[model samples]
Target: MSYLRFDKTLMINLEESLPREILRTNKSGAYHCTTIVDCNTRKYHGLLVIPVPELDDENHVLLSSLDETVIQHGAEFNLGLHKYQGDNYSPKGHKYIREFDCEKIPITTYRVGGVILTKEKIFVHYENRILIKYTLVDAHSATTLRFRPLLAFRSVRQYTHENPHANREYQEVENGIKTCMYPGYPELFMQLNKKNEFHFEPYWYKGIEYTKEQERGYDSNEDLYVPGYFEVNIKKGESIIFSAGISEASTNDMFEKFEEQAARRTPRDSFFNCLKNSAHQFHNKQGGKHYLLAGYPWFKCRARDMFVSLPGLTLAVDEVEEFESVMETAQEAIENYINNRPLNCKIYEIEDPDVLLWAIWAIQQYANATSAEQCKEKYGDLLKDIIEFIHKGKHDNLFLHDNGLLYSNGENKAITWMNATINDRPVTPRTGYIVEVNSLWYNALRFVAGMMHTGDKAESIFADSLDELAKTTAQSFIDVFLNEHGYLLDYVNGQPSDWAVRPNMIFTVAFEYSPLKPEQKKRILDITTRELLTPKGLRSLSPKSIGYNPNYVGPQILRDCAYHQGTAWPWLMGFYMEAYLRIYKTSGVSFIERQLIGFEEEMRKHCISSIPELFDGNPPFKGRGAVSFAMNVALILHVLKQLNKYY
Candidate 1:
C-alpha cells in the first residue's frame, strides 16, 4: 500500500473523496489543483491557474478542467466528473476510479470493464504548464480516448457566466489547438504528444456548482466554455502526453518534459518528506527574484509570513542556498522600506510593525543553523539597521516609549497578526503593547547585542546601548503584560488590559532570549497548554474567553470574525514545541512526539501531504482556510528538525 493511496471504496464515494484536494505548483506562480477525484469543489480549483501580471495581480484560470472519455467497442464511457445544480453530478466518472495515489505524482487509475487507463499529472517547474500522461495499462480490445477541456479564462476570485462576449474560435497548433477566451488574457496552448482529431463543438457548460463556495456563502455557480474535444487512438501498454500551458511547446518533447518534471518531485512517501515537498511548492520565483508565497489558492507573498516561515522552509530542509536566496529578495524589500521608496518586489505588507522583528528571528535561526560568525558576516548590518530603525521611531505606526516598550496605534487598523478586519476596522483590536511584538523586540535586542558584543566590535558603544535597552525592555514587558492570574495579557492599553488567552504569549517562551524567569515561563506555558492547545495546534483564543467562535464557517464577515477568535493555527505549534523541548529537554521529546501524531494523521486527510492555514477549534477540528499554507508546513518542518536534535 502506498502512503497516499485511496482505493475504489474511498475514491468512488463523493462524500469521502470530494473534500480531499491535491495541489501541484510550478515553483513559479502557476498551479494545478482539484479534488482527488478531479472534481473542483472550489472556484480556486483548476487544471491550469497562473498569474497574469499584465492583466492584474490575481491568478487567472485558463484550463479549468479536462474531462476524459474511454471508448471501447463503440461504447463511450465518460471518465469525468462535474457537479451541477439540483444535487446532480453528470458523467459521474468517479465511479470508474479504481484507485488514486500521489506518492510520486497524482495518479488516478480507472477501470472501465476490460480497459484500465491510468492518468498521471505534473506541473512543470518554473513554467506555466501542466502535463497529463495517459497510459493504457490493460485492454482486451481496440480502444480510443477523447479529451474535452473546459475553459474559464477569469480571475480565481470571480466566476464567469454564459456570455455572448466569449471568442468561439481557436487556432490549430502542433497535434492540438490554442484558444483565448478574453482579449486581455493570454492564449491557452493545449497539445498532445501524438496526432489527434479536433472536433470543433464550442458550447457553454453552464450552472456548474462549487459546493465549497456555497458552504462558505459565496457565489458558487459558473459557466465554463468548452471549445471542443480531441479524439485519439491508443494501444495497450502505450502512453500519450497532454500539455496545457500559457505558451506553446514542442509536441515531440512533451513526454520527455513530463518525465523530467516527475523525476524532480520529492515523493510524498513520509510525513517529513510530505512537509519538505509542500515547503518547496511555496517558493515563487519571478523577475529573477525569489519569494515565499504565504499560502496556496488565494494568498500571495506576504512579508510577515515570508520572514516567519523562511528559516523552517529552507534551513530545516537543509536547503541553505534557498534560505539565502529568499533572504536576498527580502533584504532588498526591507531596504526599499527603509529608504522610503516603492518596493519593487512582490512582497505585501512589508510595512507591518512586527515584520522586521520576525526577520531578525529568521536570521537567528540561520545563526543557529550555521554559526554566529557566518550570520554576523552576512546579516550584521541588516540587524543593526532594523534595531536602529525601531529605536529612532522611523516606522509610521510603531513608537518607542520612554519605558522601553514598543507601542503601536492600531486604533482602526489591524496591526498585529490577529489581523482580521470588518469594514476596514480591526475585529480583534490589539492596539497597545502587544505581547508577541514586545517579546520579539526583547529577543531581537538581546540576540543582536550578544552578536555585536562577541563580534569584531567587542567594545562597541552600540552593543552596550542594546544590552542596556534590552534589560529595560525586559522589566517593562513583565510589568505591562504579566497579570495576577500568572498568565500574560494578550495586550495592554492602560485603559483596561485585554486579558484574552491567545497564543501570542507563546513567543516569550519560544524565543531564545526571554524576559521572564524560568518559573514564570513555565507558568505561561502551562496556561497556554491548558487553555489554547489543541490537537491541530494552539487556538488563537481560549474557549473560556468571551466572543469565542470555535468554528470557521458562514459568510465572509462571519468567517473573518472567527478568523482569530478561536481558530487553531498549526504554525503556533512550532513555537509551542520549541518552548516545550527547551524547558523539558529530553523528557519533553516523547510528549512532543505524541502530539505530532495528530498532524501526521492529517497527511491523509484534507489536502494530502500538505498542512492547511487554520482549523476549527472545536471537536473534529476540520481544516479550513487555504488548503496548503507555507507557515504551517514550514513550522512543522521546524518541529521535526528540533526533534531530530534529540536523536
Candidate 2:
C-alpha cells in the first residue's frame, strides 16, 4: 500500500535551456531533422506555446510537420476573456495551416521531409497528431535545436479513420508522395495581460533544472498566475513553420482571434503543477469521485482509460475527491463496457477487449485507499454493475474459464489494447492459452472480498476463489505465458507464441497480486530492467526479437508491427515501479531502495515532467503517443504514494 505526501509550497520554476540540447529519434530509426528551436509551454501537453526555429539557412529550409487546429479554447473555454486578434487584438502572421500552406502533407515519416541548405538560423514550432521529422543536409554548418512537449490527444473517433498516408491497414506502403495542401484553420491566439490569470513561464517544469526568473506571488492574487509562453531569441534568419489542422475557419469572432493568438503565443504552463493539475482534473467538480473519461485537455469519455489513469490523476494531487470520483466513474464505466459487453465496445474510444484487468486493478486501488462510506455512497452502483458484468461472463466465458484466465478468439475480435494491426492482420491474436487475465481476475476478486465486508458469504467465496485462481494461474498460466527460461511470452494460443519477452507480462511480475513466486519475480524484473527498459519506458518487446521495431512511426503495418513488437510503452512504467516496490519491501534488498529512489531520479531526467505514451526502441529514441497518453505519469505518482522516503 502507498501513502500520500503533499508539499504544496514546493514549486517548479524552470528558467532556460539550450534548444540545441534536444536530440530526438523517430519511429523509423531515422534521424528526424533538427532545428535550433526556442519553444516554451507551461504544461507537458503544451496547451499554449510560442515556437520558431533559430535557423542558420533560409534557402535550404524545408518545413513539413506542423499542428494547426482549433482545440478546446476561450471565454467559456479560457475562463471568459477577449480573444486574441479581437478588434484590439493582433493575429500571428507567421503561422501556416498545412495543406493550405504549401507543398505536401504526408504521414510517411512526418508531414514534411526535406533538407534546409541555408547558412542562417531556422526555428520551427507547431503541434499535431503526427510525429515531427526534420532531416538536415550536411552542407549546412549549424547547431540545431528542437522542442517537443509530449503532445497528442488520445483519439476515439466515432468511426475508423483512414490512415494519414496509407489508406490500407496492413502493409507498410512505401511508395508515392501524395500530398494535401488545402485551406485549414489557423492556431488559436488568446488575450493575455489579465490582472488575475494562470500565468506560465515557457518551458518550466517540476523536478528538473533550468535558468529561472521569478517574482513572489501574493495571496491577494487568485492563484499561481499561469501565463502563456514567450520565446527569447539571439539567432538570425530564424523562420518557424507553425502548422496544425485543415478546415474552414469558424465564423465566431472569438474563435478567429483565439486562433490568431494561438499562432503567436505558445503555452508554457508549469509541468510540475500541470502534472499534479492534470491528474486532479479528472474528477468531477463536487469531488465525490467520477471520471471525466478524457477531459477537454484531450479526448473525452474514456472510462477504462480513466480508471487505469486513476493512479496517475489521484496520486499526490492534494485532493481526495478525484480518488472517490474515479472509483465512481469506473463503476459506471465497467458496466457500460460490459453492457455493450465485450465486442469492440470498451470504455475507451478505441477497440474493446478483455484486458480490462487493467481497469480492475484501479478498482482494487480504490478499495485499498479511500473510505468505505465513500465507496458505498459514490461508487456502490459502479461496483455492483462491474461485479454483475463479471458474474455474467463476457469474453471467453471467463466466468467459467475456472482455469483462472480470460481471453477471446477469432479474426477481427479484440482481446486487448494491442488490437490494431497492419491492414487486416491482428497484431495480437491469442485465441486461447491462460494468461495475466486470470491474475487480474484473482486480484479483482480479493479486492471485492475486502470491500464487501468480513462475514459476507460472497466475500469468503471470492477470497476462496482468489486462492484457487492464483493456484490455477500459477500451475497453468505460468508455464503457458512464459518461455523455457521463464521470461514472459506476448500471449498464448495453443502453440507457443514467438516466446518474446514483452512489457505486458510485467503486470504479473510487478503487481501486488502477482502470480509469480519470489524467484520468478526476480528473474523477470532483471530481464525487464536490462533488455526491455529504455530511457523513456519499457519496450513493448525485446529489441533482440525478430518482431522488435526500433522506430515508432511509419505505415500502419509497420507501426502496429512495432506496437507490441518493440515500441517502448511509458505507461507501463507505473507497474514496473509497483513491482520494484513489492520486491524491495520484501527481500529488504538495499537495491530496492535505489529502485524506489531511482524511479524518481529517472523521472527527473525523462518522465519527471509527465509520462509519455511510447518511445522509439532505437538509440536516441524519442517518445511516440498511441493516444493522448498522460495517465501513466499520474499512475507513477500514485505508486510513489507507498514510498517511506521523502520526495
User: What C-alpha lDDT values do all the predictions have?
Assistant: 0.93, 0.41
The runs of at least 3 residues in candidate 1 whose Cα sits more than 4 Å from the true structure, single-residue gaps closed, are 456-459
Prediction 2 TM-score vs. true: 0.55
TM value for model 1:
0.99
Across 347-400, the per-residue lDDT of candidate 2 in tens digits comes to: 454234443565667656655566656554555445555655665675333444
Q: Candidate 1 — which pairs collide?
A: none
In angstroms, how far off is 251's CA in candidate 2? Answer: 21
TM-score for each of the candidates: 0.99, 0.55
Which candidate's TM-score is highest?
Answer: 1
